[model samples]
Target: MNKPLSILAVYIITAVSADESEPNIEEICRFVAPGTTILRPNTCEQWVRCPTAFGAADYDDGSCVYGLYFNKDTGRCESIENVNCPYESNIVKNRCASKKTGSFLPHPTNCKSYIYCQNGKEINATCPNNLIYHPTKVACVYAKQYECELKTFPANANPICKAIPKNKILADTKDCTKYYKCNKDQQLVKLECAEGQSFDYVSSKCVTQKSAICHPLAPELEPESDVCGNADNVHIGYIADEKSCSHYYICNKRANGRPDRKPLHLKCQNEHFFDINTWSCRDRLRVQCYLDRCEGIENGYVNVAGDCTAYAHCKNGVTIKRGKCGEGFNFDERLQICSQQNISYVACKS
Candidate 1:
């Protein structure tokens, strides 16, 4: 019986420990209730209300509640009644509650004047005559530092009313052809374009010469007209010479602009042939001629003379023979003459 009683006591102690370790669901839910939210993990508190409230009527009692001012004259709490405060106000323990001031509010119409609310009153302020209030800087600054919007003005009018740098060009408002440049004394000096030139607004410069219009051709030959005038009468697709059809010529109109004007002649080089499609010179294999036999005594060839024993050769398209015949003969190519009797012939070999 004693052993059973000790076991029962141990069981009861274990049951009590388990029950104490369990979480309280109802207490946890109450701590998160509305108007009594949980401030932290273990803290549950409501937001505190300031004793003094802005814009509250004064109470009859001398003592103010909710930290409001008890105004004796108005018989109420000092309120933000007459204060035209642009910004939020602060509440103090004293009945006199005033909005925070010194926040610069620029005047809508005047760049020099600014206003601020202080002690329930709007106080106006101004900068120096030449200075303007800068909202970004929150201070007064020279007017030159401000970049103001430009307004419409008459032709050649200097609306800036300030000194412009020398040699600066300014355009006229009413006329596109007129312009002015600032002189050393900051004075406007009118200027105009030259006789044959026109003012180019896009480039802001005077264009003195006009581009010549020419007939279009292949891309490679498009600029040919500029150099050689116009392609009019030349053979369109033939080589210039017979030796090798590599170099080709093109006839271009003269620059005199006359219908009877002669066309200019141009040719490609030796290693290139004129391409009709591209109208440009293209590379090609150079052709050459070589002969191993003599016929008709062609240029640069050696042949047996009419005498059957003597030889004559052609050089530079002209036939030439040895000054004398082989041992006992005289030969003349022009006379077709050869004889052994004319041994003393000075024109023949000795």
Candidate 2:
């Protein structure tokens, strides 16, 4: 330029120059201020401050990184430090795996441990601070996170639930008359009727189809002339008059042999006798049957051959022959006459 600018006054742009020479002071002053953020254009490398001066821009290997810069002196990476970093750069480690990132499984593996590396070798590489690796979910989570595992569930996962059809089996359990059991197809079927009873589905109450008969309760039998008396002391009986059409019976044991027996004798007529014993008379006609013969009435008879005879008076002084006045003269009370004699006189000769 004019008189060739002096070396000290020469304006040099080191960002564009290929030579490694002294950097311009104005360029260093322009980059070192606070809130400066930039990277090298060619390499895209990033650093927190200016390479020539401290507190210039945020950068890492030509790519700009985000961090707060601390001092404005000593223009190098050692001189410029991050004010907001929690730990050293080589301590945090991240893990990624196929099982974690696959679309079928939505879980992911995050930063899992603090791994310190020096000279390309691991130092104190430990698992994450308060977490462990879950093999099922393939993710790092806090320790003892889950109480139960999926495999230990009560039901299997394959079969989907469905609404079952309504049927008789469910209803049979409520009011089943017959004993029922489930078939292979899960249907209720009748086995048999219960003991001592047969099933009647229509009635739904157990029934005895045929029942046994008990003996005729307290039967009483007596002779033809006598009334009903206690046969084997169970049923009582009595004697009835021959002329009476009604018969009598006594059922009260206390009044059976008692002298005050009028209260116990329930005298019932022939019409009532049929009703009490549930029987009917077969011999409809017999003149002697009108009288209920007691002992000898079956053989008892009265013979009337002719009209009334006379009463012959027997005196103590008179010699009465066979209770007649004379052999052929018979005295009659009804006619009071001694008719003309026709003598068949054997008893009169005495």
Candidate 3:
């Protein structure tokens, strides 16, 4: 039986014979398709060796075609195909992978890899631009490659933008409090409401109650004041009291003379004024009111009996306790104890 010729034996013979027809660049250029740019040359073949020419191949690292030797240029591999054609082993100058749109010449990063060069455009691409044909992934992928100039893109682009994928857009927080960035420029802002609810630009997270509430700082009569009347009319000599309410002047033995009284509205009978000298009102005939009114001196309080009830004190709801002179006596609101210091009376809490 005839032994089948081993494949290695044929390959060895072919390799040797292929080395014999090495041609010069002139002959190599002829084999290149017309208008095709021959960037480098083949160097593996021995007979094809020639002196380097202008734009000729440079030192090639073991890359050969049909045993034909070629040189390298500009970091590209040079080699000859069958001694006539020149090709780059490291990279292939190609256009976009899309056969439909004849793309511009592309210098793919990896010689073995293919890149998207849309419609003969040399610009890098984005979402709509030419995509990357990642051999490992074995599928077309959309890259956010910043090479895009403005709005140009490739024709066979996949993963066409579906409203920016909704995941990328984030709201604008005026305080930079929180935000999100999408592959596309769509965003929404978010914040926390005072009511401890999360809120977004579209709506409030916490609904507010609608009823009106009383203010804690509402204005009211001072609880410590001996009298509760119009605050503007309390001071004497500042204004003339109207008729029965004539503004009275108080003489301060220390402050030169009595303050000139000016006209003012009427004030209730139970009013008070701070004495500049004594700093407290007294119940002497000289210190008493011009209208025969009682006064309150230090440790003394005017009583309802029309007596000088000294040291009288009022509790909550104005339950006035008579001074020592009227021991065991306290004013009762039910009895309207405005005159006598009456004990055995109960005062209600407000």
38-104, model 1: which lDDT tens digit per residue? 1111111111111121122221112333424322223344343321111112122221225455555
C-alpha RMSD between model 3 and the true structure: 32.3
TM-score of each: 0.17, 0.13, 0.17
After superposing candidate 1 on the true structure, give the runs of residues whose Cα lies further than 4 Å from its correct spot: 1-112, 115-124, 127-134, 140-189, 193-197, 201-204, 211-350
Tens digit of per-residue lDDT, candidate 3, span 1-350: 12232322232123223223322334332212122222232322222222233224442223333323332222223322112122223233223322335332222342223344455333443223456443345444555432312222122111111111223222222221232222232112233333212223222122221221111121221212112222243433323222222123332221323222222223323344322244343222223232212232233233333333232354432325544344544444233343355333111111
Q: Which portions of model 2 show Cα errors greater than 4 Å?
A: 1-36, 41-109, 118-120, 123-350
Model 3 stretches astray by more than 4 angstroms? 1-325, 332-350
Q: Which has the higher lDDT value, candidate number 1 or candidate number 2?
A: 1
- Stronger candidate by lDDT (2 vs 3): 3
* Model 1 lDDT, residue 274, Cα: 47
**How does residue 232 of candidate 1 score in lDDT?**
49
Summed over model 3, clashes come to 38
TM-score of 3: 0.17
Model 2 TM-score, all chains together: 0.13
Count clashing residue pairs per candidate: 14, 18, 38
